[model samples]
Target: MEIKTKKFKRDLLNWYKNNKRDYSWRETNDPWKILLLETISQQTQLDRADTYFKLFIKEFPNPETMASSSLKKVLILWSGLGYNNRAKRLYESSKILCETGFDELYPNFEVLPGVGPYTNNAILSFAYHKKVITRDVNVDRVFSRYFGVDEVKTFIHNNKKTLLDRVSSRDLNQAIMDFGSMVCKSKNPLCSSCVLENNCKKYIVKIKRPQEAFSGSNRELRGDLLKLLLSNNKLSLKKIEKALAVDREKLLKATTTLEKDGLITIKKNNLVEINS
Candidate 1:
C-alpha cells in the first residue's frame, strides 16, 4: 500500500528543488560552523544571524578554542542577536562536545544541551548533507496548516518523525523552511506561487491565519534585554524590571528562561554573559 504522505512529500520536494533560498549554511560542510549558525539563529532571523555567523567564525575558529572562551566576548560578538542564552548554550555545547575529547567537529545533537531537533537537522543537512527534517516556526506552520496540528509542541516533539519518515529529512526540513519564508509567510501567503499548494494543509483546510496564533511571544523581550545588558554591562533586576516595564514576575521569568536556555551566567556581582 502506498503511504498516505506520498503526495505531501512529492509536492514539497518538488517545490523545494525549484524554489529555495541561497542561504549561508548551504555553502559549508563544517559541523562546528553549522552548529554555530544554528545556535545563533534560535528565535532570531536568518538575515541578522548571517552577519554574526561570519563574525563568530572569525572570533572562535574551532570547537576546542570556543570551548575555552569567556562569555563577555561571546555576548560582545552576539551583540544585536537576542536570546543571549542561545549564544551561551552554543558556548556550553562547544565545551561539552570538546570535553568528549574529539579533536574534530562534533556533529551529534542528542548530547548537546540547548539544541533541539530543528538545530540538530540543520547541522546534519547543511553540514553533512544528511537527510534531516527541520521544523522551525515556518515548518511548524506548514505542518499545522496541512496536518491538522494546532499545538506546536505536539508536532515538533511527537508527530515529527511520523510525518518526516515519509520524506527525506533533509528535503522535508529544507522544503517547509523555504515554504514558510517565501510562500507561507506571516502576512500574505503567496498561495498561487507556492508549488505545494495542492497538498498544503492550510490550503486544503481553507484557513489563512498565520502562526500569529502562537503570539504573545517572549522572543522580542528577550532580545531587548540582552542587547541592553550587553551594552550597559550589569543591570540590576530592579533596573531591568523598571526599564522593560514588565511585572517583576515577567522579568524574573525572562531571566530564568534566558539562563536555562544558556544565554547568561549569574554571579555574586552581576548577571554575566556566557555566549556571543
Candidate 2:
C-alpha cells in the first residue's frame, strides 16, 4: 500500500503538537546550545544527558565559554557520560566555531569535529530553519516502519522539497523523532497507540541489543578506574585493581586502552591520574 504522504504529515504534526516532550534543549533556537546537546546526546542516554546538558550549558553557556574552557575541565564535567573523546572533540569544535563565524561554519559543517550527516542536517533545519531532512535513527525508524520502505531517504529525497512549504522540515523532522522515540520504539513498539498505526503497514523488525556484559568488560573497568581517579589525585595500579576487583590481565588491557585514549596517565610512581 502506498503511503498517503499528506495524511501522514498531518497526523505526525498533530500528534507531535500534542505529545512532544519538553526537553530543555528544544525550548530555544540557539545553534551552539543545540550543537552541544546533540553532541552530548550522541554518546549519552537522553535522560542522563538531560541533567548533564543543563549543567554543561550553565558551565559553558556559549561558544566563547566552551572554547575558553580546558579539555580537562570539560572531561571532568563529562565524567559519567562515557565516550570521553566526544567531549574533547566538542570542546575543539567550539573553539573552531568561536574563531570562525556560524555563517562560515555551516558550509564546513560536515568536516567539523563532531558534526556528521544527522548533526549537519539538524543544525541546518533546527538552527537555520532550512528545508532539509534530518534522518537519524529515530526518524529513519518511524518513516521506514510507517511506509514499509527500507530506504526512507529515497522517499524523502524525492518528495521532501515539494512538501516543504506545506510542512516545515523542522516540524516534520522533530515530529518523526518524537514519534519514533515515544510510540514506534525499537523494542516492543506501541503500534496501537501510534498515530500512524491505521495507515502503517507495520514493517517492524526486531533489533538485537548488544550483549556486552559490564562485569568484566573493558568499558566497565575503565569506568571503575576513572571513578577512583576522580576521587583522589591518583591511584596506584594495585589500588585500582583491588578496588575494581577485576582480573589482572583484563585490568591491564583496559588501562592500556584508556591510556591510549588519553583518558588517563601513568606517573613515574605507577599511580594513574586523569590526563591533564
Candidate 3:
C-alpha cells in the first residue's frame, strides 16, 4: 500500500494545529541554541531536555561564547544524559564552526557532525524556511508503520529529497515528530485515534503490537552490553558472555550487532571499546 506523503503531512499538521505542545524553543530561531537542544536531547525525555537546554543557554548563549567555554563545562552540564561523547561532539562542532572563519558564526545547516540530515533539517526547517526532512526514532517508527518499510534507514538514506520536498518542512517536521511521539507510539499505538490510521500499513499488516518483540529483544541486550563496555574499556567476548551468563551464542550475536552498529570495536583478544 502506498501512502501519500503530502496527505499524511497535512493530517499531521492539522492535528498539530489543535494538539501541539507549547515548547519554549518553538518560538526561537537561533541556530546555535537549537543545536544545543538537538544535542542535549540525546536519548532523554523532552521535559528533562528542556531543563538542560535552558541551563546550557544560560551558561553560553551564543556560538562565540560557547566556543570559548571548556568542553569539561559542557560535559558537566550534559551529565546524566548517558552519552558524554555527544557533549564532546557538540562542543567540538561549535569550535570547528568558530574556527571556520565564517564570521565566527554557526554554519548554515551544513558542516556539522552529529547534526545529520535529521538534525540539520530540524534546525533548517524550524530556524530557517528551508524545507528539509528530519527523521528521528519517533518519525522512523511512524513511517515504518505507515509504509511497512522495515529497512527505514535505507529508504531514508536513498529518498532524502523526495521526502523533504513533500512535507511542509518548517511546520510538518516538528508536527510529524510530535504526532508520532504522542500518538503513534512504539507499543500498542493509539491507531484508532491516529490521523494516519486510514493510510497506515500497520492497519493493513494487522499487527497488534509491532514493536513489542523489539523491546526485550537483542536491541536491549546489546545496550546492556554497551553500558558494560563503555564503563570497562575491554574484555574478551567469552568473558562478557560468561558475565552476562545467558549463552555464548547469544552474547556473540549481541556483541556482533553492537560492533556492526559502530557503537563498539574489537581489539586484541576480543577486547572492545566504544567508538570515539
Candidate 4:
C-alpha cells in the first residue's frame, strides 16, 4: 500500500492538534526534564511514569542536584518504580551531563548510560525539536500498521523528509505516540473512530498477550527485597531469606542479579543493602 505522504502528515498533525496528550513533559523544552521523563517512561505506563517524574523532578530538579546526591537516596525515591537500574543510570547520566555539559553532548546522547537509539532520538525530537523520529513500540506500531510493513525503520528512512517537513518534531512524535496508545492500541483498537482509518493498510485488531504473573515471580521477590532494604539500612542474608520466605538459593540468585545490576550490594559480612 502506497501511503500519500503529504496527506498522511496533514491528517496526523490535524488529529494531533485535537487529540494530543497533555503531559507535564510537553510543557517545557528543558533537555534535563525531557531526559528524566523519557528515562522514567521506559517500560513503564504513562500514569506511573508521570508520578515518578513528579517525585524526581521535585527532588532533583536538575542534573547537578541528582549528581550531588547519593545513589541510595535516589533509589529510595525510585523504590516502587521497578527496573531499579533506571534510577542508577539516571544518576550516572546526570553526573556525566553535569561534567561534560548538555550542549557538548548534543546528537551523541547514546554515550550516556542507558540512553539507547529510541531515547537518544526522543531527546533530540522532544527537547531539541530536531527532525528525528523516535521509533518506540507505540510509534513503531502506528507506522507498521499504516504502511503494512514490518520494516518500520526502512519506511521512516525513505519518508523522513516528507513526514517531518513543516512539522514540529516534538508535536509529531508526541502525536504519533498518543494516537497509537489511544486509538491503535495493541488490543481493542478503536478503528472506527481513528482519523487515519480510511488510509490504514492493515487495520486489524492486535492480539493481546497475557500478562506475566507477578506473584511468585523473581520480579516480585526482587521488589520485596528492595522494600526490605529501603526500610532498613542493611539486612543479613538469613534475615532477608526468612522475611521473604524464600529458599537460600533463590535469595542468593536474586541478590546476585540485583548486585550485578548495581542496584544493591552484598557485603562480606553477609549483609545486603542498597548500593551507595
Candidate 5:
C-alpha cells in the first residue's frame, strides 16, 4: 500500500497525460485567476465552479477589480456558488493582495484568507511551478486506495523524493487529481478501466462509504437563506422564514449561526442582510 513502485507512478502519470480533462483553469499561470479558481472551487463541484469562474473572471478579471468592488455586490454576483462566505473572503484576500501585491501574496501563504494547506500547495505548484506536493480529499482518497496505506499525508511527506523524482510537481499533482476524479471515484470506481488497476491496493481490498444527502442540511439552508438575502439587500425575519420553507427552528439556527460567522447580520427590527 505504499505506492513505492516506479511502475505505479509511470502508469498514473501516463493515464493522466492521455485522459486529463482540459479545464480552463489548468491553462493559466496567472496567480490572481488561480487564486480565484482555487477559492471558488473549495466546496463547489468542478462544472459549477468552472461556470462561476468564467462569470466571475469576466466581471472582476483581477485582484484590483475585486478589491475595489463592494462585498454586497460581490455576494450578489456569487449568489449561486454556495458557501457565500468564500466570496467575502476572496474579496478581503484580494484587497490585501492589491495593497501588498501578488509578488508578496504568493510567497506568504498565511496572509491569504481562506487559503489552507492544500490551496497553498496548489498556488505554489501550479502558479509558480514549485515542487510542492498538493493533496486534496481526492488525492488523499487515491493515495489511500493505491498505496493501501491510510496515512496519506504521512505517506506523501515521507515518500516525496521517490514520488516526485521522475515528473514535474505540477504535472504529477494534476495527474493525481484527474486520476482520482475520473477513475478512482468515491463510489463505483472504474477499476477495470483504470491504468493503475494492476498497482492499486484498494482495488483488491475494496473500501466503501455512504454518500451524505444535501437536502435540508445546515449548509443547504444557509445557502438558500443567503440567496434570498443576496437578491434583496435585507429581509424581514418573517419573510426569510417564509422564503426558506424549512422548519422555524432550523431556519433560526442557520440564520443565527450565519450571523455569528459574520456572513449575515440582523438589525433590532429583525431584518437580515449580508455583513458589511
Candidate 6:
C-alpha cells in the first residue's frame, strides 16, 4: 500500500500537536543549547539528559564559556554520564564554535567534533529551522514501518522533497520520534491507539533484547578507574588494580583503553591520571 503522504503528514502533525513531549530545551531556538542537548541525549535517557543539560547550561551557558573551561572541569560535570569521550569532544567542539562562531559554522556543523550526520541535521532542523530530516533510529523505525519498506534510506532518498514540503521539519522530526517511542515501540507497540494505524503499511514487532550486564564488564572497570581518579589527582597502576580489585593485566587493558579514548593518561612510573 502506498503511503498517502498528505494525510499521513496531517495526521502525524495533529497527533504531535497534542502528544509532544515537553522539554526545557524545546522552548529555545539556541543552537548551542540544542547541540549540547543532542550530544548528551546521544548516550543518555531523555530524563537524565535533561538533568545534565541543566547542569551544563548553568556551568557553561554559551560556547565561549565552555570553550574557556578546562576539559577536566567538563569531565567532572560529566562524571556519571559514562561516555567520557563525548564530553571531551563537546569541549573541543565548543572551542571551535567559540573561535569560528555558529553563523560561520552553519550548514557545516559536522566539522565540530562528534557532530555527525544525524546531529548536523538535528541542529539545522531544530535550531535553524531548516527543512531537513534528522534520521535517527527512532525516525528510521517509524518511517520504515509506516511505509512498509525495509530500506528506509532508499525511500527517504526518493521521497525527501515530498516529505519536507509544507511541513515544519522540527515538529515533524520530534513527533515521529515521540510516536516511535510511545506508540510504535520496538517492543510491545500500542498498535490499537496508533494514529497511523489504518495507514501504516506494516507493523513490525521487534523482540526486546536483554540489556547486557554492566557489572564486571570492562565498562564498569573503566568507570571505577575514572571515578577513583576524579576523586584524587592520580594513582599508580598497582593502586588502581588494588582499588578496583582486579588483576594487573585487566587493569592495564582498561587503562590502555581509557588512554586511547583520551579519558586518561599513564605517565612514567605507571601513574594514571585523567587526561588534562
Q: Taking the tens digit of each residue's C-alpha lDDT, what string does model 4 give over 141-216?
A: 8887887877889989989998888888888888888888888887767888888888888634355677678888
Quote the positional error of residue 62 for candidate 2 in Å: 1.3
TM-score of 6: 0.94
lDDT of 1 by residue, 122-178 (tens): 877766666556657677677766665677566456544555664556667767787
Q: Is candidate 1 or candidate 4 better by TM-score?
A: 4
Q: Which stretches of candidate 5 lie over 4 Å from their true place?
A: 1-3, 203-212
User: How high is each candidate's TM-score?
Assistant: 0.68, 0.89, 0.66, 0.94, 0.91, 0.94
How well is each residue in 1-276 modelled by candidate 6, as lDDT tens digits? 224776778899999999989999986789999899999998577889999999999999999998888998998998888878799999999999878988898999999999999989988998899998889877888888888887888887788777888888988888888888888887677888888899887746445477667888788888888889988869998888888799988888888999998888899989998877
Give the lowest summed-lDDT range of ten residues in model 4.
202-211
Cα-based lDDT for every prediction:
0.69, 0.80, 0.71, 0.86, 0.82, 0.86
Candidate 5 displacement at residue 99 in angstroms: 1.6
- Report the C-alpha lDDT of model 2 over 168-232, residue by residue, as the tens digit: 77788878877887888888899877767898878857476876886667887777777677778
Clashing pairs in 3: none
RMSD value for candidate 6: 1.7
Which whole-number lDDT from 0 to 100 does residue 24 have in model 5? 91
User: Candidate 5: global Cα-lDDT?
Assistant: 0.82
> Per-residue lDDT for 223-275 in model 5, tens only?
88887777787998888877776777898899898998788888899888877
Alpha-carbon lDDT of model 3? 0.71
> Please, what are the lDDT tens digits per residue for candidate 3 over residues 84-143?
557767877878867673233333455766777667777776777676567787887877
Can you tell me which runs of candidate 4 are displaced by over 4 Å? 1-3, 203-212
Clashing pairs in 4: none
